[model samples]
Target: MPTLLLVRHGRSTANTAGILAGWTPGVDLDDTGRSQAAALVDRLTGVPLAQVVSSPLERCRQTLAPLVEARPELGGPTVDERFGECHYGDWTGRPLSELALDPLWRTVQDHASAAVFPGGESLRALSHRTVAAAREWDEKIAAEHGPEAVWAVCTHGDVVKAVVADALGMHLDHFQRINVEPCSVTAIRYTPQRPFVLRMGDTGDLASLRPRPAHGPTASGDAVIGGDTGDTGTP
Candidate 1:
C-alpha cells in the first residue's frame, strides 16, 4: 500500500481577514504559515516521502519548500492544476460572513451537495475533476514507485477533504465532515482492499509523533466542531 500525505497550505492574508481567496493569485503564506511549514518539514524528517506533488499556487508550493530544503535529494514536488482549490469564480475575494448570508451558501452547508459560487464551479463538478485527477496520479505513483512509497500532496483544505473522503470510500455527502486545518497534515494509506485514514488535523502534535499505523471503519464523522467551512481552497 502506498501512503498519500495530503497537506493543506499554510495560512494566508485572506485567511486572517475572513475573505474567500479562491484561485486568486499573489496570496502568499503569512509568518505563522512559514513557521508551520518549518514544523511540517521537521515532522517529515523521519517519514522519508518518495515524491511530492502540489497545486501550482504559490501558497501550496511554498508549503513544501522547507521539505525540499531539508532533503535536496527528494528534488521538488510536481504541480498539478487538478489538485488546485475550488474555483470561486466571482466570489473569490468576498468576505466569508457576507457570503454566508446568501441562500445558496446555506444549501451547500446543510446538504453537502454541489452548490456553485455564482460564477464558479459546482461542488459536483469539482468532485468529479479532482477525483479523476487523483486516481490518475495514484496509478502513476503506484506504477512508478513501489507499494510502500509515500508521496506528499500540497493543496488546499477543501480540495484535500474532497479527495480524501472519496478515496476512503466515504459518501460524497461526507465531504462536509472531514476538516483539514491550515498547515495541517492528513495521512491516508491505501491498499487494494481498503484505505485507512491514520491521522487528521495534527499540526501542533507533529513533533514527538510516532509512526501512526493505519486503522479505520471510516468513522462516520465530519470536520472538527466549529472549524471553518468557507473552503478557503475556493476559487
Candidate 2:
C-alpha cells in the first residue's frame, strides 16, 4: 500500500475576508498562509516523500512552493486538475453570510449528494472525481516506487474533505462532518482490501506516517467534526 498525504492550501485572501473565492483567478495565500507552508518543511522533515502533486490553482501552487524549494529531489510539483476547488458557479466570490440565507444552503448541508451548485457541479460529482483521482495516483505511485512510497497532494479544503469521506466509506452528505483546516495534512494508505486513514487534518509533525516498529507505541486519534455546506467561503 502507498501513503497519500492530503494537504489543504494555507489560508488565502478570501479565507480571511469570509469571501468564497471558488475558482477565481486572483486569490493567493495571505502572509500567514506563507508562514504556514514554510513551517511544513520542518514538520515533514524525515518523511520519504516520493512526489508532490497540487491542484492547478494559484493558492494551491503557492502552498506547495516552500516544499518544492526545500526539497528539489521530490521534483517540481505536478498540477492535477482533478484535485482543484469545486466550481461554485453562481456562488463564486459571494460572502458566506449571504449564502447562508439561500434555501439551497440547507440541502447542501444535509443532502449534499443531491445538491448541485447552481451553474456549477454536484457534491456527488466532486467526490467521485476526487476519490477516483486519488485511487489512480495511489496505484501509479505504488507501481513506480513500491507500496511503501509516500506522496503529497496539495488542494482545497473541500477536496480534502471529499477524499477523507470516501476513505472512511461515508456518504457524500456526511462529508460535511469533516473539517480540514488551512495548511493541515491528512494521510491515507491504500491497500488491496481497503484504504486506511492514518491521519485527518493534522497540523503537526508527520513522523507518525513513518512505519512503526512492532513494539513501538501506536498512533491513535479522533476525527474533527464540522458541517460544510459546499459554499465557496468554506476552508
Candidate 3:
C-alpha cells in the first residue's frame, strides 16, 4: 500500500475576490495564502514524504514551495496535468456571485454528474481523470517506494474533492458535501483491495490526523473505513 496526501493549493487572488479561476493563468497565491503555505511546513513536520507532485497551476506550485524547502530530499515538485484545475471554459474568470444566479448553478450543486459547465468539462469527467491519475500514481509509488511510502499532491479544490468522492465511492453529485479548504490536507492509502481514506480537510496539526486501520468490509469485499464508506457522516 502507498499513502497519498492531497493538499489543496493555498488561497489565490481569485479566491479572495470570490472569482472562478478555472484554468486561468497568472493567478498566484495571495499574501495570506503564502502565510498559510509557510505554516504547512510546520504542520507536516514529521511526515516522511517521498515525493511531491503538483498541478501545473502557479498557485499549486507556490503552495508546494515551503514543503520542498523544508525537505530538500524530496527534490523539486513534479507537475502533473491530470491534477490541474477544472476548465470552466466560458466561465473561466467569472465572479462566483454572478454565476450562482445561473440556472445551471443549481444543477452543478445538486446534480454535478449531469451539469456541464458551459463549454467545459462535466463533474463526472473531472472525477474520472483525477481518480485515474491518483490510482496510477498510487501504483507507481507503491512499486517504486514500497508500501510504507508517503507522497504529497498539491492541486485544486475541485480535483481534491473529486478524488475524495471516488475514494469514498460516493456519487459525483454528493461531492459538494465534502469540503476541501485552501491548503487543507486529505490523506488516503491504496491497499491491496480498495483505497482507505485516513483524513480529510485537515488544515493544521497533522500529528492529530494520523491514519487508523479500517474496521470493516466494502461492497466489493475489501476493507474500507472513513469518508462515506463506513459512516454516513463526513470525514
In order, candidate lDDTs are 0.75, 0.86, 0.85
User: In terms of lDDT, which candidate is strongest?
Assistant: 2
Q: Candidate 3: which stretches are off by over 4 Å?
A: 208-235
Q: Between the candidate structures 2 and 3, which one is better when assessed by lDDT?
A: 2
Model 2 ranges off by over 4 Å: 212-235
TM-score of 1: 0.84
Instruction: List, residue by residue over 1-235, the lDDT tens digit for candidate 2.
Output: 6789999999999999999899999899999999999998888887778989999999999999999999988778998899999998999999999999999899999998988999999888899899999999999998999776789999998899999999899988898999999999999977666677878999988876765332222212222246322221211
Most TM-score-accurate candidate: 2
Q: Tell me which of candidates 1 and 2 scores higher on TM-score.
A: 2
lDDT of 1 by residue, 15-105 (tens): 9889989898999999988888888877775675778989999999998999888888888888899889899888898999998888878
Which residue pairs show backbone clashes in model 3?
none
For model 2 the local lDDT of residue 87 reads: 91
Q: What's the TM for model 2? A: 0.90
Task: Report the Cα lDDT for residue 3, model 3.
Answer: 77
TM-score of 3: 0.89
